[model samples]
Target: MSTFLSALAGGALIGTSAALLLILNGRIAGISGITAGAVMPLSRDTPWRWAFLAGLLLGPVLYRLAFGAWPVVQLDAPWSLVVLGGLLVGYGTRLGGGCTSGHGVCGLARLSPRSIAAVATFMAAAAGTVFLVRHGGW
Candidate 1:
C-alpha cells in the first residue's frame, strides 16, 4: 500500500477504536490516561485498562503477522535524547490534559474548543522545536 493509504487506514482504525471505546465503555481512549489507570487501577477499571494496553503493545506484532514484515522505523536521536523526549512528552501530556491521540483525534472529532487550542499549541511548539533544531544548531 502507498504511504497515504496506509496512513488513512491507520487513522480510520484509530478513530474507530476511539469511537467504540467512547460508545461501548463510556471512556476516552487517551493513552496516558489508559496507561495511568492500568498502573494504578481501580478494581473495576483493571480489566479493560489492561486489555487496552495489551492491544497497544501487540498492534505492531499483529501488523507484522498480517503484512509479513515489521514496519520500518528509523530513530536518529541518541538513547538519552529519546528518553528525555519521552519524559518531556509524558509531562506535557499531564500538563495539557491529554496526548495527541486524545486531543487530535477524539477531542477534535467532538468539536472541542479546548482540543483545538491544545492541538494548535502542540503543532506550533513542534514546528518551533524543529526550526530551532535545524537552524539554531541545537
Candidate 2:
C-alpha cells in the first residue's frame, strides 16, 4: 500500500477502536491512563486494560506475521536521548492530564474545549521544536 493509504487506514482503525471503547466500556482510549491503571494495584478494570495493552504490543508482530516482514523503525537519536524523551513524554502526559490519543482523538471528537486547547498547545510546541531543530540550529 502507498504511504498515504496506509496512514489513512491506520487512522481509521484508531478512531474506530476509540469509539468502540467509549461505546462499549464507557472509557476513553487513553494509553497512558490505561497503562497506569494496569500497573497500579489490581482492580475490576485491570483485565481489560491489560488486554488492551497486550493488543498494542502485538500489533507489529501480527503485521509481520501477515506481511512477511516486521514494520520498519528508524531512530536517529542516541539510546540515551530516546530514553530521556520517553520519560519526558510520560511526565508530560501526567502533567497534561492525558496523552495525544485521549485529547487529540477522543476528546476532540466529543467537541471538548479543553481538548481543543490541549491539541493546539501540542501542535504549536511540536512545530516550534521542529523549527528550532531544523532552522534555529538547535
lDDT of each: 0.89, 0.88
For each candidate, give its TM-score against the true structure.
Answer: 0.93, 0.91
Candidate 1's TM-score reads 0.93
lDDT of 1: 0.89
lDDT of 1 by residue, 23-115 (tens): 999999888778767887756767998999889989999999999998899999989989999999988887898888888887899999999
Candidate of highest lDDT:
1
Most accurate candidate by TM-score:
1
Q: Candidate 2's C-alpha lDDT? A: 0.88
- Assess the local accuracy of residue 90 in candidate 2 as a C-alpha lDDT between 0 and 100: 85
Over the stretch 9-112, how does candidate 2's per-residue lDDT look in tens digits?
98999999998999999999988788878888356779889899999999999999989999999879879878987998888887887878988888899999
